[model samples]
Structure formats: structure tokens, C-alpha cells
Target: MTQVVFYILPQSLDNEPEDVSAHFIQACAIAAFYYGQSNKVFIFTDNQQDAFSVDEYLWQFDGDSFVPHNLLGEGPRYGTPVEISWQPPTHPRQILINLSSNVPKFAINFQQIIDFVPASETLKIAARTRYSTYKKMGLTLSTHAVTNDNAVESTKKAED
Candidate 1:
């Protein structure tokens, strides 16, 4: 069964209410941490702009954390350690960092999924729909709370 993990952001980043950059940062951190463990990661964005944003941010997310990644159609045929795309990954990956509004139909192809529940109420509602959909799929699901202070480390901090 696929395992789904949700990282709930406690607050918006940079004091911008409901800012999405926080989600992107956390997703990058998680992808980098998993890549260190030899996991193939795919970041599924909502659109081309978001995919490009993540591709750019992943490069400078941290001075010490380096995640070799490329935007879909720009990377190697099989892709790098991490791949950002507005579409589903062509090949199955070990982990998926979903930054979309709804769960994609190809989500079950991955062994694990990393999703986010933003600080905004409107976003949370959309997240809940995804949560319910996953629950109905009978997948193993878990959630963790992340704060701006620990967002980077929180990826590696998941217990069990």
C-alpha cells in the first residue's frame, strides 16, 4: 500500500498570510532529505509556473542542502534525483511531493507521497478533500505539523 504523509504548515512564511513559498520550501527540504536516502523524488506542481518556481527554488533552498533536480522535459530521460513537473511522472518514483490542489490519478504509482496543508483556511479545505480521497484509497496516511523554525529539519525528523 502506498504511504501518504501530510505536512501541515503552522503559519505562512515571511509574515505573508497564506504564503505558498513556505510549502515550496518544505517540499524542497523533504525532497533533498529523501534524495540523501537514495529515494527518487518527483515534485508535482499545479502548473508550469509553479513547476518552474520549484525548480528554481530547489537550487537555492539551502546553502548546505543540495538536491540535484531538473524541470520535466529538461532533465535526463529518466530524470535526476528530483524532478519537477506540472504533469505526472512518466515513470514510477519512490516518493512524490505533491503541490497541486487535488491528488493526481497517478499518485498510487509511488510508494510514498508528501503533501501539504497550508495555513490558509481555504487551502486547508482543498487539502481535506485530498485527504479524504487518499483515505478512501486505503493507503497508509500520516500527518506532521511543521513550523517555519523547523520546516527544513522536519523532513528528516519524521518518526517511524
Candidate 2:
């Protein structure tokens, strides 16, 4: 049974297009922490651009640390803890973190799925739909509403 979790990011104050960069960095930090715990993570983006963005941010997310990761179609780099892609992982079965607008097709492949809903109403609605879909699928659902304070706490927990 796949366990699906949604980590809702703090709502943006302004009405600009949700800057996902900070969220991505936070996601990367969480993934890196899980990697430390010996879990492999596959991050699914909506498209190649998002994948590239994640790839770049992962490098600079932590100046002192590094997360072993590669973009999809780069050939499998054995020992990489993280894999970022626009498509589902070539080989399934890992902790999946989805940044896609819609629920990924391969959501069932992994034992666990982590997704986030930003401040945008459009995104919130989409996430709701995904949540319902997951519910209908009979998967376990867990949600964490991330505020700035808790976001910092999560980062600290990940670091520890």
C-alpha cells in the first residue's frame, strides 16, 4: 500500500506566480536528509524545465553539502541517491516526491509519495483533486501544513 503525503507550503503574501524555487530548495533539503537515512528519492517535475531547475538548485541548496543526483535521460548513475525527471523513473520503487501539477501516473510504483501544494488557488484545487483521487485509490493519506516556522523545524529535523 502506497502512503501518500502532502506537504503544503506556506501561502505566498503577494499574488505573483508562485516562486517554487524556495520550495524546491526545501524539498531538496528534505530529500537530502532522507538520503542520509539511507532512503532513495525520486523527484518528479512537471516538465524538463522544472527538472532542470531542481537539478541546479540541488547543487546550491547546501553550499557545504552535496546530494548525489542526476536528471532523467542522463543514463543511470549508480549510487545516486536522488533522480529528478519530467517522466516517471525508469525503474520504480523509491520514495517519490512529485512537483507535477497532476498526480503522476506511476504514483503507485513507489511505497511512498510526497507532494506539495503551494499558495496558488489553481494549485490548491489541483492538489485537492489529486487528494481525492488518492483517496479513491484507497491509499493512506497524510498532510503537513508547512508554515515558515515549521518549515525551519522540518529542515532542522532533516539535518539531524
Candidate 3:
């Protein structure tokens, strides 16, 4: 199964470390839902001792109960796949989810949310939007565009 991994970083690492930590936890919940599996969702932080604390907070949400299998101390490794086993909801709903922040080098994947849509029409719509955004931006079709387009579209709608 394809997996989505998000590298969590503190927003400032200076003034608002706590807020950045809170945002990281919230992002994990969103990531869990996007991946369509809460059970096997894995988060990687900046190899800090406090990283587990953020994971603990994220696991407390309803439908967000997941066990942590820490990979921090595994030592220098390259391209290791994190294991995940998520039971999808019996009846899923179409949701226009958006996650944004004034941070650089952030990414989210569409495969995370694709498993939840049971309808072909909804999937097609998502695909079209994803394609259109990629065409406009001249960037490769990626999960980041699918996730970022929500914010871009919202801004366009607001301006219109």
C-alpha cells in the first residue's frame, strides 16, 4: 500500500515552539484522516526527545487512536517504509479538507484521502482539479498540489 509521510517541524523553533508543537499534532490528525488509516499512521519529527509528546497528543483524538512505533533511534537509514494498517469507515463522507500554514517545504499527499471516496464522480472531480492546478502551476501532479489547491481555490472563490 502507498503511504504518506509528513516531516513535522516546529514553526519557529524560537518564539512559538509550543504553538508549532500544537500545529504539528493537529497536522498528524489531518494526516491520519488523509491516509485513510489511523491505525498505521507514522509521523517523523526532527529527531527531538519531545517528538513523542506531540505524537501522544495526536493519538488522543476520536478515530485517531494509533500506537506509536518510534523509528527515531533506528540510526542512519535511507528509504525505509513505515508500516500501516487502517480500517476505513463503513460510510465515508465527501469532505473538502484543507491544511495550510506560512511555512516552506511542506507537503501533503492525495493518496491519503483517495481511499475514502466511494463515488467515481467525486474522484473524477478531484482528479480534474488536481490536473488543472498542475497545468496552471506547471508543476508535476503531486499530493502537495492536491492538498494545497484547497487553499488556492478558497482564495480564488473569496476574491471572486
Give the candidate number with the greatest lDDT: 1
Candidate 3: residue pairs that collide = 34-112
The 10-residue segment with the lowest total lDDT in model 1: 11-20
RMSD of each: 2.1, 3.5, 13.9
Taking all chains together, the TM-score of candidate 3 against the true structure is 0.30
Give me the candidate number with maximum TM-score: 1
Assess every candidate by TM-score. 0.92, 0.85, 0.30
Candidate 2 worst ten-residue window by lDDT: 12-21
Better of 1 and 2 by lDDT: 1
**Which rank order by lDDT, best down to worst?**
1, 2, 3
Candidate 3 runs further than 4 Å off: 1-20, 35-41, 63-160
Evaluate model 3: give its lDDT.
0.32
Where does candidate 1 stray beyond 4 Å?
A: 14-20
Query: Against the correct fold, how does model 1 do in TM-score?
Result: 0.92
Q: Model 3, 56-115: lDDT tens per residue?
A: 554553453453333333422321122111212122222212222111122232223211
- 3-49: candidate 1 lDDT, tens digit per residue: 99999997665443243377887888799899999999999988999
